[model samples]
Target: MSWTTPSDVVALLRKRWDAGAYLGRPWEPVAVPLRGPRPGELADRFGEAQDWVRRWEQVDLVRLERVRTGGRVIGTNEIPRRVWIDTFEGLCALLRVGPAARRFEHLLELTGRRFPALTGWVTAHPMKTLEAADDWERLLAVVRWIETCPPGLYLRQVDVPGVDTKFVERHRGILTELLELRVDPVDGVPRTDFAGRFRFRRKPDYVRFRMLDGSRIGGFGELTVRAEEFLAPPARRIFVLENEVTYLALPETPGAAAILGGGYGVGVLERMDWPAEVELVYWGDIDTHGFAILDRFRRRFPHVRSVLMDQDTLLAHRVHWMTEPKPTRQPLGALTAEESALYRDLISDVYGPAVRLEQERVRFSAVRRALGP
Candidate 1:
């Protein structure tokens, strides 16, 4: 009959409730205009219209405004024109979301009572509050513990009764938001780095290298040490390669050490105090990003040299060349003329689109020759 039904009114309120509109604030009486049958339909389909009216009349949780209308079947009749839900309780009852709404209200109450500053956060993130409702108590306890504890403790050292590192890790996203409301954010720490943002001790960066002079640090020839604790080995030559296999397979040189380079993470080298006159050489895939990493590394160690990354090496291994999935095309200021030209050719697809020649793909004999006797 083109008239609004009781279900229609409930559906509209349900959408508003799910959107978190009515949960954050007290409900005010909201009157929704009802769509009624046209005058012609009121007379033509009197019985169906009456049944529709009967549905609205049966609904007791809402008030219905009526208008006098006349038709051939009746001299005058009161027809519903609008439905008004006068209370939050009435709206929840009509929408059947009472339990979930009550839970959110409890969360609001607890958050307001304990952490008044986070009350707005609860209102803005009602759904998030509900999702974390089961863990809200423990989450609050963790925040309280962090508030009283000294800074610089690791996540494992967060000594809440039931909260563990895994729990904090799992809830770091929400915790970061809540903690920011209470704690002062540390400078130079990105918000995404939850530990750093909250002043927690972060895991240390490690550098892995092997002493090729057959010398061992204590016992192990290859060792991974904290970047800040790494002491430069007494070697005249340092060979850095992105491929771990290539770094490991390097034949013993008289006074050379091999470092497993972590792509663009060559900045770790800056943590070490390199000795004077030690030649630093990097060998990476003959691709744009490889040259980019070499460029970034050379920015710090301007005297660093690159091996097996020239046009000769790339052309010699044409059979092993593959397409770079995502090639970097940015200009590299630290590259030599030859390296710059080769980098240009790679980005411009001189040989083929996005060409790449991995260091491991080069013949070991060729790598050995590059290393020199």
Candidate 2:
């Protein structure tokens, strides 16, 4: 009963097409073995077997191979043993993907004419090429612009006919693939970084800070500046607080300032050059991740110290304790002995299961005391 049906043949052809096998290699006659009724099946259901053979006779797209079966009930009759699609056109016609196949061929022509180097990509991703058939020309235009345009320009500055920043953003994945084939990647730029790989000017990272000493820079109490342009304020102590509210609510301390640390994004701070004599202090949640952030910050600024991330601070605020959800167990190389001990306890669940005490929950008086005269 499980004989190869017409729909099964079509599915097999489509599977090959979907795999890009048909597009990549030279067209050859494809022969699919047909599962005909066995001798027992022929003897038991001779009329039903005859009807199945008649079904294949109706389908003209494939050339059928008929083999005689020696049977007992019915005289030996021919049944379709194999179905052969003699040409690629016949295969496409049977699959009813003729229009899509023609569009893919057109894409091949266009890619060969304009970007000959990307011919392999066209063949390898025939379906993808067909999917983008409407916007194929515009996608190529973006690539052409990228090739000839001056370096260091933002993606927004890419001027091409019928192509905007949104189009580029939408098609960035495909563009990255195509561009990688044509453009030499920038040194030190990871392949996953779309902007860096193509040398486009990326969005600037901004660092936000508040002057705790009442000292005004451009007469502003709080300021956000591009990381590259960030210059240290006139302060002997810099308190990097993970919570924005804590950074904002800090009592004014003479010759001290606070920066809103961006958790793991503290890597951006490495771009700025801080004064050597300035004391850098970090205050974050008394959790494994908080210690991890401090450890990362200390990697760039070795002299950095942590405040209010101690065992005593965590124990005092037991009422504010919450589950960390996911605790980092990685050994913090830069943590001081006390910080490391606390980090170990948090990871080991010594206090409680994934215990965490957010910096914002700490008493204001304790925060004031931490910033002692």
On TM-score, the candidate that comes out on top is: 2
Superposition TM-score, candidate 2 onto the true structure = 0.87
Angstrom error at residue 171, model 2: 1.1
| Index of the highest-lDDT prediction | 1
Instruction: State how far residue 277 of model 1 sits from its true place (Å).
Output: 6.5
**Candidate 1: pairs in clash:** none
In angstroms, give how far residue 106 of model 1 lies from its true place. 2.2
Off by over 4 Å in 1: 1-12, 31-60, 65-82, 215-220, 272-277, 322-333, 336-355
TM-score against truth, every candidate: 0.81, 0.87
| lDDT per model vs. reference | 0.87, 0.86
